[model samples]
Target: MAARWLKVLAAAPLMLSALTAAQPAQALVPYVAVPAERNLEGAGLGIAQAAARLLRIGQADDAARLAALTVQLIPDDPRGWVLLAEAQLRSNQNEEAAVSLAKARELDPKNAGILFAQGSLALKDSRPSEAADLIREGLKLDGNNAGAYFDLGNAYILMGKSGDALGAFERASKLRSDFWEAINNQALVLYEQNKAGEAIKRWRRVVGIKDAAEPNLALAAALNVAQPGNTESLQRAAKALAEDPNYVLESWQKEQLWGPRLRSAAAQLLAQPALKADVERAQANAGASDDLGDG
Candidate 1:
């Protein structure tokens, strides 16, 4: 026993050096939509390449199947599990997807990969509480985990838990300050909570961050919601709507995002006789897509 202990003690310095030498403080891991296409390192390439190929051919079913198969083969690998979970989600097999993800978590409890999958699954399952718990646990494991925070915020929004969603998204933005999607979603949650001023503030931050037209459209929606009947709000929204390029208005179709409050707001705002001329002028801006139900 003493000899073994001495041997381990002597090897400790070498082990530490190897660990540090192999990976830098922030070494980039091989990952992306097409990992195999690039000369990347690690086990992620096979799954990523396979998924890319399948997606390119519009064979999402086969992609999902192969992704799940990859996870089965690489039980210890987190990326395979993530791909599998994503594929399951794409196929709408959410519950079964969660089960597959549980296997990944079992293999790597400390990894943020499976945690993101689990939280996304819980959110997809309409279990917000579970989703929040899973994602928070993931963030605790890795504070810089972008996917966990995004999915966590997404879960909160799905549950109509605005405060929790905003906090999660804010944490995500803090970690990756350049993530305009986080900012956009955070603003949306604020707007839903009737804090349109704060929502607009966040949206404006997104505009500053990415200068995306989508955020501007969202800002227009927020402006309208905040100052419902004001001529200034109308004009601002109308101008944004007119200047918008993605003619496929997303907010109106994102009913799962808005629910009754947004629907009522849209109906009331659209029904306004005074705003009719501008509404018609910005007719392309009415973005009704999905309907919401009590969740």
Candidate 2:
């Protein structure tokens, strides 16, 4: 059955294209191919598999709905519960996700994916010790889980183990080069280690992959200090402020993403006449947009 499924998956792209061509006026949407229950043997497995594919494609709400039906269809299948938890987590329904994960763990205590999700929630809740332990155990079970390593790095960062955090982030990057969060955090670790040059390099790499406002903001501040009056850095700062002015306001707080020293540095950069002017314009625009809603 696995071999047959693999063959079907290999042919799916071409088949999908032909199907799309048959309906040229409509946008193409990929769908899960589930055989009839008589052919597949387990309807619940087919539904759960579809839910997993939906979750992968950034359709978390749909995935969650399907996964809910899956658990009803096969209450004994731990995978359905785990899939539901993943979708809920993606939707930021933390408390509900925890309940689903708990049920999944009760059904399959050693499931690596359940452990990874539990670790992520623990990290988000500021329980670094528990997160670190759970994520480490999950990694031992699923050595190729890049996201588990990324969470482990976050746990280490919260624990002030910058060196260990760097190692974990590096492993995650090696596994998935496009993991921008890991690279962004790697820059944070470097900045904390007082290696401004290294941090700048990583920040540049991160921005190259995506125009993430946070990394751009951090890079602009670092460049402002490391090479005062650098034109390109000033442009980066302007772009960040224009793209995400709220970051400028929130970044001034003591609890921003960077450390105290970097935050202080960012404060200084934010005070520059040109950057401050752009941020003010952005804030005014946002205020106007909000005011329109009040009518």
Candidate 3:
């Protein structure tokens, strides 16, 4: 009976301490609920991103709706508009995407991310000239806009000016060492200039980057003209043709990239060997003439 009495007395203080701790925890219950509700508020973003990816692979309408929902869910996220713009672009709603992106830019004008989406749309619309202007404006906002630099390169390529394009892409790669887009596009300009060997070298740097089909096509073309060799280049061309059934060697530059009439720049590498030989022969002749003059 004495031991039981002592045990009852100990339980009274212990129960009092537990009640005191519970009071503070109960006060915090509402605070915890607020955050849980907020977290769920924008939770649809995961579904939106997945839907956008499907749209990018050409699901068109489904992607557009998902992007719209994403914007509804997280209107403040600049990325939300970008996702919407990309989906709209896929659905051939260029004007709408452009307007939406302009709003995104107005809200976050200094964001390089928004600039990339805007410029890509411009590129698709055959407005390389206009795209260049937008990217340049983006650069004024942020000098480290690698996406702007890439768009600049694309603009120059459309202008049939590979030298300028190469410089811009080089700058982008330097600014962001991991910039695979700049690297891939740089190879493209190189190939356009008939520097297939140089183009091949550029493509090699961005080998593991995802969705680099054009670069793959370019690599094959470059390798094809690397020498007069048959097997390898043919295989590469075959693969490119398979990937893009309508793939043309210089089709983008000649048709969509440059002028209205679409000039003939088919595999510019074909003339590279001839040009190199001419330059070398001219150098040799000049050296002989110099030797005679010296004598």
Computed on alpha carbons, the lDDT of every model, listed in order, comes to 0.65, 0.79, 0.64
**Tens digit per residue, CA lDDT, model 1, 36-58:** 31222233345456665675666
Model 2 TM-score, 2 decimals: 0.75
The pairs that clash in candidate 1 are 252-287, 252-288, 252-289, 253-287, 253-289, 253-290
Say what the RMSD of model 3 is. 19.3
Q: All candidates' TM-scores?
A: 0.61, 0.75, 0.56
Superposed on all Cα atoms, the candidates' RMSDs to the truth, in angstroms, are 15.1, 11.5, 19.3
- Minimal lDDT window, size 10, model 1: 286-295
Task: Determine which window of 10 residues in candidate 3 has minimal summed lDDT.
Answer: 257-266
- Candidate number that wins on lDDT, 1 or 2: 2
Total clashes in model 3, counting residue pairs 3 or more apart in sequence or in different chains: 0
- Residue 26 shift from truth in candidate 2, angstroms: 53
- Model 1, residue 31: C-alpha shift (Å): 40
